[model samples]
Target: MASVLRRKAADRGKSLLDMILKERKFARSIVVLVFKATRLRLSRTSHKPGSVVLISAKICIKSNSFTRLVEAEAMVYVSRSTSIPVPRVYSAFEYKQRVYIVMERIHGQPLSVDWVQRSSTSKAKILEQLRLVADEMRKIEVPEDAGVSDICGGPIYDPRLPGRSHWGPFPSISAFHRQLRNGIVPDDIRDPESIPQDLRELFLFHQQLWGKPVFTHGDLSSLNILAKGDEVVGILDWETAAWMPCYWEYTAARDANPQNLFWREEVDKFLTPNPQAWEAEAIRKKYFGDL
Candidate 1:
């Protein structure tokens, strides 16, 4: 009976949210009002600029230019397919060119909050749990012919990239690499002598590194990981999650912000290290500056 009542309540909430979404002006007004009135803002770091306001004790809404509806979709996909703990999305939509995601407001604090003070054993336990999360995400089956893309096979967004814009759902890893090289196909360069020595080396290195597509949480900073008593209760910020090359997860985690220096050093403890991929990424970034 309790389960049935909960389902009915959820359905009613969805219906009301849909009605509000239909009225764009009213929805925008409500978002602004709630954002200003709310005492708590869930988004803690400037690592990703966005506003996540707690509308109620149990619910929150994330709205920003950087947020995308696909982030909500990615959370839904992960929640259904894996044991990884993610926020439960209620509704996601775009209004006035800005995206808003309404979701469950997890009560835990970010892992970075007390990380420096935690004992070695507690830290080890948390890292072990993260390893399990990494394993579970890898077990998700990729569709045949799947390329690097957002959860729904749409273009992906990564702020750390050169333009901080949405890029292709490339047909293959090689095609993706070609895009990275600004459409200069390595094979098309018949005269390697014409290219700079470093550029030539990078192209050749990328060509030899072929990796299978796997589900990736592209931003795995400690700030995005929520913990309750050393147990990771939720992994927030799914905007950068996607189907990416096998090396992506490791490199992304390792290449975290400067503030996350300690976490960056500890990433390999939970995630499988791909030293070659890290070197390749460093080479690419050396030539093509990131945001």
Candidate 2:
């Protein structure tokens, strides 16, 4: 596997592992191991939570190309473009239809865990910091030459659509909304008609509003946020991030399952008022019936 990875890296120009390992002074400590998953696996030999280096691997079917590459690039892009903190990517390489990324391992508790103990003031401060991060995300501008309204849309490169590639890069918000009901119906909501048409209509109305492309963290769930005390030390996971419509980030955050009442209320405090939750629920009903 090492020889295969090395050859594959050479084909891409240079060995990212070779270069990055040297730079990090890893020397010979690096080990490649696997975990079980349909599409991805975590490296078992990961650094301790606060370690300066960590590695991850994703081995997918050949058609998947290199989604891990997209993830690494997104992290690097966020680190360079925003005040938001993300693990620094040391290297990313594709070999034998597998993708690997070496990066910093942030040491912090999941915000979901920390939020339970946080005082109101600390929670408020964290939300404020997130608001600033959101603002910074809005400042990211993709070149017009990219020729797509949704830069991270479709099968070209989005971690969200793993099994398929030709999905979107929608030309308009309405176009994206039209495809929202693609989810598989959950057992509880198997009846499509149970989802109110009024809700669907309301969602579409909001879709007609103006939406400009901006960088967005595709998943802003509490688990993805790493916090120490009152401060956010890291925002983990960037595979779904893309230059999406301005509302995408807030919408995703807003729509995330609220694990408790405090989180339910805090969410409202952090983002611009949008009807994303309604739309997302409506879509969920349509596809995965009430899931």
Candidate 3:
């Protein structure tokens, strides 16, 4: 009964907040006040300046020109389709070319914090839970004809990509690979002399690669994973979540931030490792810089 009552109260609060947010002047004022007073900020190296802030103990709002509604949509889809612990989104909308996502403020520290100091047993336990969460995420039904795309079947955003912009809702893995090569099709290169020998080999290698698209959290960095004790409490930052090639998850995890050097070794424990894919990604990154 207490749980039911609490749920009702939460629903009421969400409704009230929704109404409050609809008032542009009032919402702007509230955002300004929260920015000045809140201790919780969801700033990341990849996120635009002043994108996310905690509005209260329970609510966080991410709003900015770089914020996309698909991020909120991804969170909602994951919450409904899987048991992966993610922030509960209360409201998502857009006004004046900016997107706003109001969601539950999950209280936990990122796994990157103190991860190296944790005991071996604690690390194993966290990895076990993360493996289960990854499995559950893979079970989500893929949309028909889906290629590389966001949850809404739109272009996907990945800061690691060269332009730090939306890429494609490509119809096939081959099409997506072509984009990765900056539109250079290996078959179209009639004269091998026109391109560098190494570049030609890289293109050929990628052309032969094939995999069915699967749901992928494109950025599986330790900094994005929140935990309490040995339990993973939440997976934050779904902006880059999408349907991608099967090897993407492993490669993305392997490409951890420079600060998270330890996480690169731990990724294989929770996610399948694809050394070949990692090699291919390294070659691509060599030619076209990542971010």
Candidate 4:
């Protein structure tokens, strides 16, 4: 029954892709291979455009608010600065109030699916590679001429509400902290007033604990990381990527929930452990009350 439903969904995605191609006058030989709600739709085309191209499209409502152009631009920004692999953008545009992104379909499995089985030595090697990736990130200084829209927060693709479009491509770490304190999530926040007074202040106090802004993947859950053997082949889903406080990357990786025992024990191997984990937990506590 589940497989039947999945097949139906895939067919619908293929139909949607066909419509997109027809409307845009894009090549028609493309075939969709996968689909997911709020994630991405995967397809392949090998026609007049050039060589074989594997395209990943984010056209779902969960993705549309942020805009595909921002994700494409973010991927390009990181690809130019680091040896880390990312999908190349083919095109990004909007139709019917939906943002569509077509990019390289990376040919690797998500690290989350396989991390549990690897030996400790293999895990260490992978972590070393991740460390090198982080080192490359540190060297990427944000542009001096960048504006508020281009500052450290979610990409300012839409001028609507700076916080609404994305988690933040915020003006500063302090600005992000203010957003958290104000309970400005794009979706919903449960009873913001129920959060304790001191905890709210604690959240604000942490904002002053600053580091120079640096480039970050923003959300580096194992799902975003792709691997083949012990090496990470690509990192996907840059919709949340930003230039934020230096400690932001470490905080994100360490706070990621390890879904299994092996992953639980091995979580710290992915990035250098730091104080952001505790701070992040404190932030969560303020909003969600005891997790």
Candidate 5:
């Protein structure tokens, strides 16, 4: 049954025991597990099929590492509020070589950019909904279950640097810059180094100083955030979740457009995570009328 289910999931671009789901010596799964000696199993599959019931160890064992992280995270936030939008988490347990996190399988539409494009006239309404989620999220407290050290991890630049990696691009900021300059990403704005000192500083500022540090969906890309008629129903893909500054995922990530352009429909000067901002001059200027 397990093998059959795994095969079925794979056909749908979803897989239990996915390639990304690393396995252990016992052929079981592992979670934030430090030592590989333990594995987890779901104790019970509640009949009603709500998130609280443990589905099945065999099934849970098939989850990927990223799923484990999300379940563990859900365990932390579930206590806060059921009203707010988020997947409900039940457990994070380890047994032999496996780790399992039980969660309420959310029932809602997944986020897609199609709606954002379709709702241009009502863009502000959509943004407002996003802003509300952000506001509610800012209120949630990090759970003691997941340790801070485990969540934030290490700093990228200068082992000597403080806190964490630069929010945008890191290790080699220049690589991202080169991509931007060479038109790696379409509709990119900003003029590399030639940018004014103030704007340059602002570009750098966004990297470091956007949002309040909280648990963030690090992979809050278009494909990850779900929606149903403009209402953000669920946030998928917890593999990239982390405790970090706020807007990096929420504000900056929510939209792929020149944010300044949305309001007043102006594209004055923009900045992205790339090393040099001036990569795609033609397209960038076409929107702004001038780079």
Candidate 6:
């Protein structure tokens, strides 16, 4: 019900409706709509195979879809930082309280769970590719007020939004734990609260370690990637792009769920163990309790 309503006194994630209406210049003339995946589109006209044009909105959730529009703009703004090839953004505009951007739609099947099943694919190759992207990503200097925010879209007021201030990390990990059981985590939670212990602690540690608001595409799962000949060609679905920790981006790249989180194994091996700090912790634990 709240997702359906307009901005009241308090709200965080900008209402898709209000954002478009406010930025009339962007949304003008453009009919606002959503994209669905029911029909099978074949190569027609000059468009190549698998070319994504437009579709109904039955499949996409409004929040993520709206976020994609923003990321499309963000992609253009940060074009220099993108390592993976992306469909060039043609234009950006908003309409009817929903925003949109025109882009050179990719003509390849997006990488999916099956794609991760690269047996002969050397881990070295994936790591090399990830490092290349990471190298390009680190070059980006996210503007202080640029694409930045934690993952949340409740009706609560987001200062980043038109009206509202956030405490911190809206839809906190505690909240996300309930919502996030897609891959490794199971859906039917037996001991629901059990998640709070091991994982939450690690999440908190990483949050502090990479707390600075930097830019990252939150939904960097396999499905969003495009591959051809063992290489990542396009990084599609920039919807969840926002300010986040530097490490967060890498963390996402490592989360190859279908094959277990091994794709990230190499990256994690290098990053997690800060030799000095790890040594200090070891010594401290030797003297006191490892708590």
The 10 consecutive residues of candidate 1 with the worst lDDT sum are 36-45
lDDT for position 83 in model 6: 53
lDDT of 2 by residue, 197-227 (tens): 7654645454566545666776777878888
Model 4 residue 39 CA deviation (Å) reads 12
Instruction: In angstroms, give how far residue 3 of model 5 lies from its true place.
Output: 9.7
Q: How close is candidate 4 to the true structure, as a TM-score?
A: 0.64
lDDT of 3 at 44: 32
Q: Please give the CA lDDT of all the candidate structures.
A: 0.78, 0.57, 0.78, 0.58, 0.40, 0.44
lDDT of 5 by residue, 1-291 (tens): 755544343332212323333332222232222111112222232323222222233222224332344346543553364345655443455554444554445544544446435655454555566566555555667544332222434221111112332323222333323322332332254556555555444445334422234555544444545667767666654544555443334333423434222332211111123323233322333433331
Runs in model 5 with CA error above 4 Å? 1-62, 65-67, 78-82, 95-98, 113-125, 141-212, 250-291
Displacement of the residue 243 alpha carbon in candidate 2, Å: 2.3
TM-score of each: 0.82, 0.66, 0.82, 0.64, 0.43, 0.49
Tens-place lDDT digits, model 1, residues 1-291: 655544443334444444554453335544444553342222344433347865555667888778899999999999999989999887777777877787889989887778899999999999999999999999998888788888789998888778757888888888888788778765787886787776776787778756668989899999899999988999999999888888888988888787787898889999998787787777788777653
Report the lDDT tens digits of candidate 4 across residue range 1-291: 766655655556546554665476543223222224212323232323222223224332222344556777877878877788887664565655655566666677887887777797877888788778777877887776332333333353322223354454566566655554565532253887875665655655555667556667766677777888888898877765666656656655555554533343444566566654556656565564432
The superposed Cα distance between candidate 2 and the true structure at residue 208, in angstroms, equals 1.2
- Residues 1-291 of candidate 6 have per-residue lDDT tens digits of 432322231231224323443454333332233221211122434554332433222111222223335555557755756655765664455455555554554545554544446664544465467556656655667554432343232222122221223323333333322222221343354776776454444334433433344556645555666766567677776655655545445544543456445444454532332433333323433433331
- What is the number of residue pairs that collide in model 1? 0
Looking at model 2, which ten-residue stretch has the lowest summed lDDT?
Answer: 33-42
Which is the better candidate, 1 or 4, if ranked by lDDT? 1
**Ranking, TM-score, top scorer first:** 1, 3, 2, 4, 6, 5
**Candidate 6 positional error at 140, Å:** 0.9
The 10-residue segment of model 5 with minimum total lDDT is 263-272
Local lDDT at 116 for model 4: 71
